[model samples]
Target: MKKTFKVVVDCDDVLFDCNGYAVTKLNREKEYAYKKEDITAWGELGCGLDERLIYFRDPVFVRDMPVLPKAREFIQALSRRAEIFIATSVAAECAGERVSSIIRNFPEINPENILIGTRKDMLKADMLLDDCPDHIRSAEVTYPVLFRQPWNLSVSGVISTTTYREFLTLVDMVQKPEPEMDPMSPVVLVGPSGAGKNRVATALEETGRYRRVMGYTTNAGSRAFYRCVSWEQFHYKRNDFVETSSYMGEMYGTCREDVESVFREGRIPLLVMDINGAVNMRLEYGARIIFVSAGKEECIRDILSRGLPLEETIRRISSIDGEMKNETLCDMTVSGTGFRVSSLEKTP
Candidate 1:
């Protein structure tokens, strides 16, 4: 049987040859020959200030451009197995043009699923296919793939494919005869206090396929999942951490060495943090964000069992509402109850 996953794709270079189309149009008008390789950067495309806006902002230019080779065919094939979304970043001027074109050309995509926004990081899906390195790196999805283009060929540390057919085969997520994994990215877990995130992380470690990363912290009272440090020591070694945060006036952070050592040992790094910490780490790790939740009532009940002081318990409880809102933004959400290795194994 084949595996399925949600995929959000970009418009400019992934699905349609927007840049290439502009190049062709410019060359035709100027009677100059410019190949795709010549466009290593937007500035190199030889468009002046006014010209760039006129070309990319025009509805006709967007709607009539030829689709990238095999993009339509592979997308149609993928629709049979996945929940496909067209998440394109465009100006409001031509947003409708992009949407109308997709609706007319790809009937497999629901019109309601076409998303127009520049904040691609806010879009939740298992995978995201985009040509921009900034967009790919910011995505908190399980599989943030770079759709290779002449400009993005040199970008490193992300999974990439050169063609639509190759992308289709690459995201065949699990249980296939030759399924593969990209060990470059870490699997990050986030939840509110008393959400049983620690329990879930421990379960992943017991599988022996993952190593729970030990974060460094200045929380003097903390004894688990962290190596406590003095404030002076933390300030001295501040550069060593990839991300840091404060909770109830206690500082915590994940060290670079902790995550890299797990990679060198051939085990995936598992991190349990708050939402902000997880998103901050994605700048370099491309980490897959999973929001582990046990619901508000259950979380409060669990916190009370810990026998914490009244003020501290109240502080944690107040943050529950804000933490719950992040569930929909993460790549995946799993109940803390009975969550096991299989939950992590189900995706790419």
Candidate 2:
């Protein structure tokens, strides 16, 4: 099946003759003819090498320059199937003129789509065309098409198009795929204490794929755990803070309010849980359960070394190694001994 997508075009070199304007600006001011290598010299002029890009800021730069060969026709054709956004970056001082030049080129282009910032990181366009190497590198995060310019020959690991038509051809060859995710289900991870349950969650958060839901508890908080409740709330009078299976004079329950808070933030919530809580959540929400474990001796040693009580540590070791129905609740078991938080992964 053919894939449909939104398109964003870059103004400078891909659609407009920016290099020609840059050459003209230098010649008019310096009384010298422009050369391709002269581009580097522009960066070296006034206010260090950075100030040279300021020449593109002049409104006349875009007004006087002609559209790149066939640039206008290609954009008009692509606009039929895609919502085209003209995403570009120009000097801040001349933003008004730069935007004016853009609108003058394509009378129908939306002013909202005309961007003027360096944080190409914030842009969410499907395709971008420019001559600069750094702009291409930044757009890779979202798989946007990057048109090659003379300045980008030194960049690596990037696919480049030399012309606007070639870019359209490139996007046509490779389809932009939509993501598949279970609408009602979130990616769930479960593991024993120190088995790296929270560690794996931390890793996922870094990738911007999932969100961490602080597991609620009735027990006194521990800093080692990813999220913990303060003693004040643990001692607060509430039925939700009751014990799971009375071992001594302690209570263990997942704080429903906290978990829900994470969901409210519009991200897939990740919760660390004891076997009882993990299983309960699985039954209630049918959440994906990941069981993390370690050998009896190794687990016990780790538990104690982290300052867990000896009696409590021994109790956990016995249950994990014993023949118990709870052991079957895990969807996946990952080795936790000497576990590096960064190495955790989910089995597909």
Candidate 3:
């Protein structure tokens, strides 16, 4: 028989009261995202949501935050039978503070048991009881017990419960197997403006299995763009036959040999470039291409929301749009809206 000895719990509405706490204290304008109507607004914090999330992550804040009735009791009871954890989402800005907060709240619980700022789907657990449908839906857990509440009403495949006693009963009965990870194949990714080529590339890199080709180019505003060099430096550094291609008074070249070097390596190469580049590569080597795209408004929204300097954001957007208009590219087209690396790789 397999070992059955671990459970992870969500901190927000499942353990503490989120909707009530937000209603009582959360500032509408500051805490919530911008919307034309107030009551109609969902729990999205628009412009500075990433920043405001930092406040709640502090040890002073979390310890003082009210714990739900029977939450501590249920956890204590479960702790006797299995290791229990308080897992919650931590925003990028205050990831440290969030971990500190959980450690302070439950001194008895080991620091390792508390995880924050994690993709719930990536978590390895025998069972997970959360109020958020996204958390349970995304995770491949053995027993996904949905704590019955207004927030979790729409979720499917959940054992609804009003009390911790009831939740514990369901947790005791379910049996689940460890999920298997399906490795991705070696293939090329393509996308238009607002399509998530860079994002997809990053996701693949994170797996540590895919060997992606980083293209060498002249557009180096950010590291995301190709590695750039001036005309004098390019010619001096690389003593090659001079081929001139000027854009906005700046000269650039595609180093054919450097791209070929990537193919020589046994890794999957990621070439993030225009349709011409893809076509040129296809002619040289028959590589597969996957296209990525997003709606105009969604693209603008995503770009602006990243907390980058406004000028830099606008410049990148303009450049991406320019490429989209110019390129006539590839095999499969995927939506850039709400693009997640795991979702894209899993898609057929």
User: Candidate 2, residues 246-267: lDDT per residue as tens digits?
Assistant: 2223434555565566567766
* Best model per TM-score: 1
- Which segments of candidate 1 are over 4 A away from where they belong? 1-4, 42-53, 175-348
Query: Which 10 residues in a row give candidate 2 its minimum summed lDDT?
Result: 241-250
Q: Residue 119 in candidate 3 has what lDDT?
A: 78
Q: Residue 259's C-alpha lDDT in candidate 3?
A: 50
Backbone collision count in every prediction?
0, 3, 9
* Model 3: residues with Cα > 4 Å off, grouped in runs: 1-4, 27-42, 45-63, 175-348
Ranking by lDDT: 1, 3, 2
In candidate 3, the residue pairs with backbone N, CA or C atoms under 3 Å apart (3 or more residues apart, or in different chains) clash, namely 33-46, 190-290, 190-291, 191-292, 195-292, 195-293, 211-268, 213-269, 213-270
- Every model's TM-score: 0.49, 0.44, 0.41
Error of 2 at 156 (Å): 2.9
RMSD of candidate 2 to the truth, in angstroms, is: 21.9
What are the per-residue Cα lDDT tens digits for candidate 3 across 137-227? Answer: 6777665556656434333223345467655544443321111222232345644445667777777678654556544334455354455
Count clashing residue pairs in model 1: 0
The models' CA-based lDDT, in order, is 0.75, 0.55, 0.55
